[model samples]
Target: MSNYRNHFMSHIKTTIGELLEKLEQHNWRHSVYVNEPEDTSIHTVCFVIDTDSAELENDVFTPSIAAQNGLREFLPVHDLQGVREYLANVGVSGTPEAELFAIMHYFKWDTYPSERELAAYQ
Candidate 1:
């Protein structure tokens, strides 16, 4: 994976880990990251979505879908929603991590999603 994507992926994982602490299930997997093909230099973040809604008690990393290390089951974008969008549109945005995830989630998923069952975290 590109260094940029790798950096952001780790960032999202950390963010999700923190988010999980506040959720009902503090033990569910949040997200995963991996390098993408050279064709797209930007990067890719895949959010996992389980229609079954089963609870996972440990950290999950799903790479079966691709060669890079994406979170298990699926991945989700953390941005692309609420004030964050407003901030970016108004030129007052540029927060790292979350903002980056939002952009990737919105563009990446929109351009190509592993499956339609789940949406980017946004």
Candidate 2:
């Protein structure tokens, strides 16, 4: 792989690791997944916190609502913000979808676009 690719991969891995560590300290369990809409071009990464401890009436709860109820904190506004900022500094677009795609690509996750396609968003 090229040196630039290696550097980007290394940075993303480190950023994720640190974010996981912080989440763990807050007793938040997390998982990553790909959300592939029917329109495949819009596939995006999802970072979810375990909600086992959250109360649900009729199973209705958004991440923000769960966080308000003492569930795992909404990572996007807190931890993931750092990742977004890093992506922006590296010339990636600031949109959530763009950040998700960049994270998915760097982490070698499922549903990521090709390197050339991703580069176009930078």
Candidate 3:
């Protein structure tokens, strides 16, 4: 991840954490978009403060979908860890560990945030 993105995510992480506290929301959802159409490394980490609605149950709140639906802006993160930490901070108490587990499960189940290897053909 570039330094600029790191800084950006850091800023948003703090802002979102504050938002989560102020909202005092228990239900939240997130979507990860790895390999963005525009830039592969530019993975998007999207979060929805409210997800109790039935319509959002099917991973409909993902980054791409959220952006398309005009629900929220696509927040970019450097890596899966960044996404996990952000979710942890925004989620209700004791949700960080759970968020990490769920994120890993989602990545495995959905095969997202595809790995990228850069090396010479040796």
TM-score of each model, in listed order: 0.23, 0.31, 0.21
lDDT per residue for candidate 2 within 1-122, as digits (tens), equals: 11222321211112233343333333223332223322222222223433444344464644443334333322332334445556656666655466656554544443334546657676
Off by more than 4 A, model 3: 1-25, 28-43, 53-102, 110-122
Global CA lDDT computed for model 2: 0.39
Collision pairs in model 3: none
**CA shift at 63, candidate 3, in angstroms?**
12
Q: Which stretches of candidate 1 lie over 4 Å from their true place?
A: 1-41, 50-52, 58-79, 88-122
* C-alpha lDDT (0 to 100) for residue 18 of candidate 1: 30
What value of lDDT does candidate 3 attain over all alpha carbons? Answer: 0.33
**Candidate 1 residues 76-102, lDDT tens each?**
333334324444445443344444444
lDDT of 1: 0.34
Provide the RMSD of all predictions against the true structure, rounded to 1 decimal.
14.9, 13.5, 12.5
Ranking of models by TM-score? 2, 1, 3
TM-score, cand. 1 vs. native: 0.23
